[model samples]
Target: MLPVVLPLPLYAADASNTMVVSAAPAASGLSELDTPAAVSVVSGDDMRQAAPRVNLSENLSSVPGLQIENRQNYAQDLQLSVRGFGSRSTFGVRGIRIYVDGIPATMPDGQGQTSNVDIGSIDHIEVLRGPFSALYGNSSGGVINIDTQTGQQPTTLEAGTWFGSYGSWRNSLKVSGATGDGTHAGDVNYTVSTSRFTTHGYRDHSGAEKNLANAKLGVRLDDASTLTLLFNSVHVKADDPGGLTPDMWRADPHQVASNVSIYNARKTVDQTQAGLHYVRQMGENDDLSVMMYAGIRETTQYQSLPASSQSSAAHPGGVIDLTRHYQGIDTRWTHRDTLFSIPVSFTGGVDYETMMERRKGYLNFSNNGTSTDYGVMGDMRRNERNLMWNLDPYLQTSWQLTNKLSLDAGLRYSSVYFDSNDYYITTGNGDDSGSTSYHRWLPAAALKYAFDDSWNAYLSAGRGFETPTINELAYRSGGVSGLNINLKPATSDTIELGTKKRIGNGLISAAVFQTDTQNEIVTDTSSNGRSTYKNAGQTRRRGLELGLDQQFAYDWRLKAAWTLLDARYRTNACGTANCDGNRIPGIARSMAYAGLEYAPEQGWYGGAEIRYMSDIAANDANSVKAPAYSITSLNTGYKWLLSNWTLDMFGRVDNLFDRNYIGSVIVNESNSRYYEPAPGRNYSVGLTVTYAFQ
Candidate 1:
């Protein structure tokens, strides 16, 4: 369960009607109220005002059926899960689809990173969870769509600054404008922003710095066609404080683990990406859309490893350097018409994506007899080039069965290929080069019925497929060499039933879902700080999600969310017949959140939020656990207008009671250093100034 607290401001452009376009990977043009799948949309202004506007984990608390945990470690990114599906990821996002302005933030190899998202310039966020998500292809446990802010009629220039706890500060500037009148072929609008942030972190030996730039440009080529371009870049440098053992955490929660400073564990990344979207209306009942994007990312990371490990031919070294180039394109056609006096719509699309990486590893020591500089690059030890690609074609349709009922269906065929070439094979090292491919035919269907003007219900079902990511296949168990070629893709069947109701000035929603998986993937073994994977016989996941939004009066509003999930392995595997009937390693069984706000159309506004989560298993065996915890936070802000300029001031406090708890855990960690501590009693203040010009 999750809870969110934010003012009910009329900042949303369409506050009365929730219209969603391209909410899915194949551009499902449907209203939120009419969609059969479980979907939710969060207003950008509400999110920015709710917290410090730093990470997605700050504002996702109000979304039902989703879980996001902040590790307080920028190098690790956020731990995100939809229902209980994506909880096994050790790094980055898995089993989910992430997109920004029609461009995929996830790679073809089923890995994703949200560090490049420009939170301050976001217009809205759409989350889709349930069976229908399988139409997106491999690893589609869920989907997240983020749309950036666009230029309006009046040009605006804005500047902002923020100062927060733990020696953190950020400065940002933005410019938006339009050229010519609002006429075809003459109208062009653009929005550009840049920001820099630095933080000393709450724990010892942990600090991070980030710089970002984002831009979006839109042009109306004609009355029936439009073109949009998006550009984004990010550079980050962060130090890993490392997880702590129970004893270490008990002594000092804010202290770094042993060897953290000695090893100088750190990571650096630079990424730049650009995308173009084109839409054309062919006729009164036909339309076409296309999107193309390309990006490059370079990263270098230093890890903690003993010198003896580096001397072994089987060891992959400690210092990792990677350069990746990725590109993709998607095209779709939509048609609308009437069949026998009944309304019907159809969409067909094709997607293709490719990525190539040059990965290398080196010793972290100088290798000058006894000379040692833990983070410096030394002799090269391992080198590999890897490539991944995917192709998917899909078709979707919606039929108005009657005045109060509708039917939606979709089918997609996905094919993924992986290839690798190892170039640093030596005496005891074998040619670890290998290639693998996977294919699947996914289908989904849903039925929606409107009981009345205030009540609606839906039922949906689908099949999902997930393949091992490149990182998961990189290393094998028992210190074996070569790729994990024996690993196979996982498949599952899912079903969901949900209902939505409008009561007075509030809306309520509830959903129950179940999934059964075959050849389920699970951690096989952990040795020498390295982890491997194996297929289990079967697994089951079921959950319930509930949400509420209400407006009590002119100045008061309430929002709440709760979730109950049960995920477990159903059969024996992992070299132990007793492994059957064990709870999943990463997810909790129960969660809840609630928030209230007051905002009387203007002046000052304030709110508070409360969140709670139950204990979580740390491994497949369920021997170790992370205890349940609760947190509270409060925030307030004021907005005033002067002449043609507007000013805003805000402040916030997190963990008001200063609770000491583990914010996140590294599931199946080899060394028992599983706990990542959250900061206690943090504060932040910020100000923004904006001016409008002709």
Candidate 2:
């Protein structure tokens, strides 16, 4: 029954060590007590404490208003959503903006993936939820910003490894150091990290391998300027175990669909990206910052769609191949001055990003003169060249109107363009080339008042939008093979009331929010493993989120997060039996998490946690549901500090009760194959060794 705490800051073992984060444009450079947004920050050290630092779902479970479900299918990545915005994504991230080291991880088209992020070197992860997120531009239902560890004094070299059930293993190496304070001319600091992970998954025919490398080199050109270079690369190969029917899941959760093995359903990806960031302290009241980046990504996937489905000229084959080249730049200026005797800070910025892609589709089966071979790439059936770009200009400001009142506001104009050229026109297919563009104006503002030094309250409102992604626009109705240029963007207006309090040794953050949307994008039809989208009339969402972090006796700490969301379709013309007033599929109505830990830097430590999720609708019809479930986990570890060398070891056991439950669902899936079951009683043990150089 402890009170909630805002996710702004988490104090260290002692109350004096405070960690703050900058998660939004208008709230940047401000501490937890000064910001007017519901921002959550998780330190890397806290994230990796005696746990496997492989997936984002590990430590991020404590963040309220967010959901991440591990589908146990690496090919599809984690199912992550902020509030309910991204609950519909089947493959990648949507309706959210992601950034790493000041470089955009999400493309201009609003589609993104986290496969390239290296968890071993992360410094912190910040999440901004609700109204203020709109300032980040397109797809901005929320924002996730990740920063890597910076090189520091007393350089260190570390090696870490983990092994667990289902033949899972991960290994990593890291080295980081600094030449000076990293602020004066000629001062240099660098950090490099690399890792390899592999797993024989919990389900049949589900195996995956991943490799990652990350580097950051920073140099201070002068006292007022610093330049940084960042590089990242990732390679992943994984088996895609498609979803199963309810009966099949109940019979055997570990079993894959029959077509998975026959079609050799799998995916392979390779991505490499590099970027440069420059920061200058211009005079005493002005600052300048610039970022430029470029990257290329290639993906090949074999789907379980029936071979016969590709026989028609309008069908996009069962095998997909894509090569994309993308680049972007951002420049901004911030000025601080006094306006009408009030302290104010103003910032203006422009972001331009573009992507060029070559897409080809082929049949998964080949037929020679004599026989047919399944699970082999055949003649190309579809080919096209696609391009997408976005240009956005935004301005943000914060004013300290009085001793107890402050205001933060921003506006952004976002313009996006998409074009496609069909290159595989056959007899009936003809030409499917098309082009389209969209424009939106987003605005957000927040007003806050401090009740005292230990408490604050805020009211905020904003307008946001979500554009159809490239994948969402790749198909149309009637088995058509052209871009769904008719799809329109979904726009929404949101308002929130929140409070944050700093009690004796605990912190609480809580908020209640509601959003109304017009022209909500929804699944129109799904068949033969492909889905098309259309504008469903309207929707409404109201939710409450609460978080609490408290430091108690000894080295013990208590943490809890809870969310209650009521998301429903308000459109009477959804074209489905239950679409008018049904709960949104794939979104749980309630979620709760609580943990108790006795963690210390040295000696022995242990922790235990429990999580609960309410029933979830598995399809738009509401005919099937994933039953609510509760699970518990426990972990223990020991650390030894011996002079220059440090050794840490840990062990974890999940699903302590061996409960049977559904882990995630494939929404609106055809053939009634929407169930993805969870595993029971999994265990892992890990260790890390580090050597400090003086």
Candidate 3:
């Protein structure tokens, strides 16, 4: 029997008014409320009240067991990791699945880039933790689901403007409305935003400029059903000042840019996405939801490094151009409350994706020549294409043995097929690749018991599986060596126990979990003097997470979360035994976050936040470690409410102390190292004025 803690006073409100649909019996797809799984929901009210500055990573730092590494340069990419997963990844998110209103935001190839989510349109965000996530088959770490608001009223308009330090300025406008009579309501929502952000940069030559836009529409059918359409896009242009070595960092943390130029180093990315979703109510106790989505992403980047600093001179001029395109489709069906006395729910889906990428090198005949004018003779063009398909089916059922005891069981089956081809233009050679297929069966079980309204405890066990990504598979190929087509899929089994308690006006939750993985994939650098993906024998990760949310008198609230992880490689078959007992690369052993907020009766509010992360190993060798760092932030706001109009103003200070740190570190095939750094201190202030009609 699980231990049950006291119920917090905040939960005493009317349960039927809860914003989360998954918590209600009408939504049968959910397994259990407190099933020992680390899950949390960020409500729309919280988001509006907090007024985040940049991306979701910054806003979600308060979530337990999650970490966001802001590589400072928007051109490179952001790193989001949970439960010690995806820490080693350099570009794009791995080991985690992202969903928007039940539609997968990540591509079918398991690579996710989420710069398109419009913060203004989001209704809420949900974070699901642990490897027992049979719901999403591709990743084992966690899942982040974002749901946007729809059909609020007949017509609504909102606009805002922001100005801040570093020559940063932003303008945003949104218009949403519903048409037709009550029986047939068609809704449309659109958002347009532009920002010109530049700084002398914490370091020299690190300035960046970006632009983003998103729009969506929803229709409600006469048959009590709904359909939604979405479109999102982003354009980012930035300068790359390059990374600093440890000695340089120790000497001058803000020192960047060895070869500063107006347009010498830069990156540009553009992406367009479209999706459709339909939901229908079949009966009093049954409902169905179907979703279909497709997206196209194109990115181009150029960087110039010092020729003497790099290990290999594929190009004597120290320059490289990278370009990629991605396209994919995802479809899913969700059914609720089907048959018998058993509460039954299930979700089944299929996905298909393709990617085309090429990288070229150029050498300059003279330093006086334009960067673009460099000669392209003997250029290397590596083309890789991946066709990936997967089908996932899952079933979940919950049984109520008594008023206080509940039993939940779930099972999922997955079938995956992948085909890859590589072409080399320099050697005028290419290879037609074969296809590989595999099947996985995962299961989960949980037991929850409630002693009273205030306390609950639960225990759960689940399994997860992941296949190698396209980038890792086609990274290196040659005359004597070939792709590792025989690579096995990584698998993990996890167990968790947790308890939640409500004491007075406060809520506290704690959980302990252990996950063991087999045939883990690790970067092997000992072979061919280049980094290659290899199957590590075995590994284990165990951790403890705690979360606290408290509301005191005078409208004051406090929230805090902490995570402690122990990640290690248990067994390895490398050329040397040095890899054994080493901590997993990229994963910090400890992370913590705390925030305090106060809202007085005078319509004034303010908050402060502190986040900290421990050091992380840069590679399997464990010879180098990224320094630990912490940051502080402050936010304050005021609102004035009149009879029919409302005005609000807010400001924030980020990286309050201007601490310097590296967000991510990577070593490429050339054995040359690169680091993505965190941004320096900055401030943003904005205002919103609204007029409502009764």
Which prediction has the highest lDDT against the true structure?
2
lDDT of 3 by residue, 580-604 (tens): 8888878889999999999774498
Which ranges in model 2 have alpha carbons more than 4 Å from their true place? 1-31, 480-482, 573-578
What would the per-residue lDDT of candidate 2 be over residues 1-694, giving only the tens digit for each residue?
0001111121111111122345322223334444577878777787898788888888888889998888888898888888888888887788888888877778888998888889899887888899988887788788888888879888999999999999999999999999999767999999999999999999998899999999999998998888889999999999999788989988999998888999999999999999998878797777777888999999999999887777877777899999999998888776677867777777788888999999999999999989988888998988999999999998877777777877878888999999989999888776778888999999999888888877889999999999998877878888665689889999999999999888767778999999998887888888776688998878898999999888888599999999999999897534736468888888899999999999876999999999999999987777899999999999999999999999999999999999999888888888788887778999999999999997
Top TM-score hit: 2
Alpha carbon deviation, residue 209, candidate 2 (Å) = 0.4
| Cα RMSD, each candidate | 4.7, 4.4, 5.7
Lowest lDDT sum, 10 consecutive residues, model 3, at: 1-10
- Error (Å) of candidate 1 at residue 195 is 1.3
Model 2 TM-score is: 0.96
Clashes by residue pair, model 1:
1-591, 3-593
Q: Give the clashing residue pairs of candidate 3, or none.
A: 5-454, 5-455, 5-456, 6-454, 6-502, 7-454, 8-502
Better of 1 and 3 by TM-score: 1
What is the full ranking by TM-score, best candidate first? 2, 1, 3
